[model samples]
Every structure is written in C-alpha cells, then in structure tokens.
Target: MTLPTITATRYVLPLREGGSLPGVVEGNDLGTYVIKFHGAGQGPKALVAEIIVGELFRRLGLRVPELKLIQLDPAIGKSEPDFEIQELLIRSAGLNLAVDFLPGSFGYDGSAGNPGDQAMARILWLDAFVANVDRSWRNTNLLVWHKNLWLIDHGAALYFHHSWMPAEKFATLPYDASDHVFSIATPDVPGVDAELAAAITPELLTEVIGLVPNEWLEDGDRERYLDYLTARLDKRSAWLPGGAR
Candidate 1:
C-alpha cells in the first residue's frame, strides 16, 4: 500500500480530538499531516470525514490540504477521536495547517463570488457519487492557507454508513446522483470568477494533482484523473453552463 515516508519511531501528540486530532511528527521531514486507518467503517470508522473525497478533489484541481498515513498507537499520542484520523494526520510527511480556515477568500462569499463553482460542481458530483455529505459552510473542512482554497477531511465518503441506512434513507442517494446540481441554482451565478478560472493553468492542475495521496487511487488512476481534467477543462461548456448564457 502507498504510505507516507515515516520513521521507525513516531511521536503522536494528545490534542482535543473531534473530527481529527492536530499533530506533529519527528522524522521524514514532512511537517504536520492528518492521519487515518485501513478499511475504517462508520460510527466505528477510525477517522470521520477527509479522506478519499478530499484527495479526489485535489486530483480534480481543487486546493486540498497535504495528507499522509502514519503508524498508530496511544503511546505515540493520546486523545484520538479515532485511529483513522490519527493515522492520516501523523503519518503525513508534510506541513499540517489543516487546523485553520476562514471563508471570504477561502472559497465562499469572496469579494467576487464562490471561489470555483463549475469546478466545485464536479467536487459536489464526486462527493455525491462517493456519498460525502460534509462540504457545507458549517463544516467547510477546507482550509484557506496562503489565499488558496484547500480541501480537508474526507474519511466520510464512499457510503460506508450504508450498512445501516434504511430503505427510506436510500432515497437521498438517488436524488444526489441527479445532475440538476452539476451546474448551480441559477444560471447567472458565476463560478469562482472568470479571472480565477482563467488563471487555472495546466501547470496548476498538474501541481494540485501531484499532491493527491497515492493510496487514494488504484495504479494509473492519477494519469486517468489528469486526463479526465484535461477533458473537463477542454469542455468547459458542460461545467460552466452559466458562461454560455
């Protein structure tokens, strides 16, 4: 399995754990990172939100936080909301500032408008397909470090809780799959502003895709993802229908 470059000895810190415990590592030179575990299930899942969805969004060219998986143990650190969260944060060999964020410039209510709607619509579609339900403002798990919208926490995707979801609950799944949302509530709601879209160069997409955790994708998924984005960027008419109007 693809894992972050970590040390034989690890240091886990005990911080207040809600969704994830903020942590620091000693080796590999990777700064702060979120951590998670293998095959984690809901209610009992090691980590909550911020796994596949976050990484996948990054692959699709959204700004997402740095992530990695680390060795786990209470001795390494205490106060684990769950092992999954602990593993992701601690294992990441990169800087972990995932602990902070403010809207405005991050991705919402900016002097312009939503940071990137057509792109976000794809994120929403991906989330819907994977069954992630924690992207709203209340949980905007995304962090805006250095004036960029970074996605965080996605251990909550891929419909793990379905094992217990009742027949009535399944209805939402069908509704979520619909494309009515692939656009926006109104056609005029310009997404992210033209300047931002104009600035999203292939180099930026490559850089963001490079950040995607290897473990999240099956081999070659990265190339396919990059290809998918190239196709999407080439076909902006589908994502940014408002622009056509």
Candidate 2:
C-alpha cells in the first residue's frame, strides 16, 4: 500500500501531560496534519493503544483521524517553538481529551443525544476485552465532526501489560471480545443502532492504519503494530458484526 509521507520542519508545542512533539505534513507537498510521539525517552503503551485499538475501531466501523509518526530530532523541538493543532474534540471545560479512564457520565446532548449509552456500552465492552480503561465523553475521547460522532486517542488499551505473565498466559486471552451488545443485526440502542457496526471495512482498517508513522514506533515496535492489526483482522475481526462473514 502507498502510505502518505511527511517531513518535519518545526517542532510543535507541548500537549497534554506536558509532552512536546512536532506537527508536520508532506513537507512542501501541500497538506495539513498534526504529528505526535508516544512519549519522551522510553516509549509507552499509549502508543500501542493508538495503533492497536485505533485500527480495531476502524474494523468495527468508526471515524478516526488519518494519523502518522513523524521524527523531529530532540534538538529541533527543544531549541524551537512548535505549534500543536488543538484537537477538535473537547469536554465542557474545553480541555484536550485522552482515553484511559472516564471520570464520570457525560452523555450526548440535543437531537443526537443517546450516543452516550449506545456508544458507551460498545466502548465499555471493547475496553473490557482489551483491558482499556480510558476514554469517555467526560474526557472528550469522542469527537464531533459535521454532526457525526468519531472515536479518537486510544492511548490506554490492553492494560494487562502492567502485569507479568507467562507466554502461555498471554496466548489465551482472559477477556471476552464480543460485539453482541452492538451487533449490526441486533435490537436498537435508542439513538444508536447495530447498523453502525456494519460500517467497518478491511480497506478502512488498512487505510487508517496507513497513517501511523514509523517514528512513533521508532524502536521496531512498528512491526508489532502491523502484526497486531493484521492478526486481529484475521482473528478478532469476527467479534465485529459483518466484519468477515
């Protein structure tokens, strides 16, 4: 597949958690984008959350940003001031959101309200399976674009990494990865319906995944993401209604 390429010219400013990164695009090629890193010094599992579960969302049919990894030498960012694009999604306080654990209930509002329950239910199920505890309306993990809802920033999935496990233990997943609650052919959930799950596509998964930058997984973890996504597409995709069958 032909993935979009970008070059870093200037370092963007620091974002939430005080981690600074660069914002870049196809340098001189004409396009707008915001690039970010997993973290400082040693990378964190949050990067895994973004790549792994982000792709999962695509497979389950969700709108997400075209993301990628860009490399900005520490010298460039530390020496210069970079502008980071503020995420369009935000809480009532208007703070940037990070998915890792919802503080409380913060559902939808207006003619498009019930999203809180339906979407939240699906997300809760996904989190239980992947061990993701973050993401919720309160934290603004959900995005609003042209009156449509979208998922973003999955930096805290597969929380089991905190525990030490034998290789065999890792082989047999301890979580249930089912979408029965939000099937493409099940009862409706008030404002939302199972129809939404049907939107997932292999091409869309491939496409959004194409946005992940090499720098983000700079330490060979990129291969892990590629393999994780590919394997899930073949393995866990069945959890998605109309995913394979």
Candidate 3:
C-alpha cells in the first residue's frame, strides 16, 4: 500500500505532551495532521520507527491513524517567536511525519470497554516483537475516538536501529511485559503470536519498510533494520509472553 505524501501548508500549534514537540499543521491535501519534526533530538530514526511499527499495527488489524510524509517549509512558521521551536522548524524544513488528526479524541481511560482480547493481544505481541518501551499505564499512547482505541506515538519502537548494531546481537532479548498497560488484561498472547508470526512474513516487512523515506536511512541502515526485525520475528515465541515455545 502506498502512503500519500503531502506538504505542510501551515503550522497551527505545538503539542507539549512530549519532548519531541510534534505540532498541528495543515497539509496541502487540505487535511489537518500532527507533524513530527525530523530535527527533533530523537532525529529521523524516530520517524522511521513510527512508520514501520505503525504500519505493522495497521497490517495486524489494529487501530492506528493514517500516516503520511509531510514536506515542511520553514517560511510557514517564520512568525513564531519561540527561538527553540523556530530553530526546530528551520532545521526540519524537509520531509517529516504527519499523523491524521483525530479531533475530539480523548486519552483512553479503559471506559469505552476493552479493545477485545485478540486485538489487545496483537498489540502486546507487536510491542514485544519491536522491543517498544513506551506503552505503560501512565502514558498509554492510546487514544479514544468514536469509542474506538487508536494507537499512536510509536517513535520509541525499533530502538535497536539507534546504535546501528548487527541484527543478530539482540535477537534473543526478552521483552518485559510486566509494565505494559495491557499486561493485566490477560491477552491471548500465544494465539496472537501464532497469528502474527505467520502474517509478518519477509514480504510484509519489506512492504512496511518501503513506507519509510530514503533520507531517513543511512548506508546499509535499511538492510540492517530489515535484518534486525526479521531476526526478532524468528525468535518471537521466545521473547513473547508465556516464555519460549
């Protein structure tokens, strides 16, 4: 599936919830989005992780907002007085990530009802597979819109890429699911594992990886990422919940 690319037409405001300073912006497509800056301290690797993991979530039949590559123009925000944000905007004046804005969405409080065991299981399984450390009770990274739970902010996943290490080095690292927000929900992890293991074939990962912009990748970085994830996928049953198969 090809993702639509849009250019930022305007910067609306800043989202202060996190250190990256993702902001609201209008796209050339006439849609509003939450744009993650490429110049953020976490840098483009975070955007790469977001696209790959978020696409994985979508392919696994989970709820995540549509992602797009947003081309930012620094001139659009020249009037903003904040030197820090201005500097970030100027530095990030190129391709960034834009998440479709879900207006009126509220943080998930577990009130709308469970996201269903199977779906929740898939989520936990994906997080484990990617070694994501962001989802917890305090900051669920989940949103509730129209009574449906939507996953967001996956920049923290695929963290192994930050070091550009060999994929095999961390293949067997166990995921600590105890702190996962859905850990207590009794997710059917084994079933989810079997389902995803079959679904996330090499072809699927390639398709997901293709969604990332080329500039985000360094020399051989893409292959290393692909290798790392494939290695992790091969060992899912070991690191996933309920221990090794």
Candidates' TM-scores? 0.49, 0.52, 0.96
Model 2 lDDT tens row, 33-112: 54434443224445545666776665665666654433334434344432333221100111111222122323233335
Off by over 4 Å in 3: none
On TM-score, the leading prediction is 3
Q: Order of all candidates by lDDT, from best down to worst?
A: 3, 1, 2
What's the TM for model 3? 0.96
lDDT values for all models: 0.45, 0.43, 0.87
lDDT of 1 by residue, 54-166 (tens): 55565556776555544443344334466765555345433222322222334433333465555565455445444555555555555555656566666555443335344
Alpha carbon lDDT at 93, candidate 3:
92
Query: How many backbone clashes can be found in candidate 3?
Result: 0
lDDT at position 82, candidate 2 = 27
Query: lDDT tens string, model 3, 154-191?
Result: 99998888886666766878889899988964347877
In model 1, what lDDT does residue 172 have?
Answer: 34
Q: What is the Cα root-mean-square deviation between model 3 and the actual structure?
A: 1.3
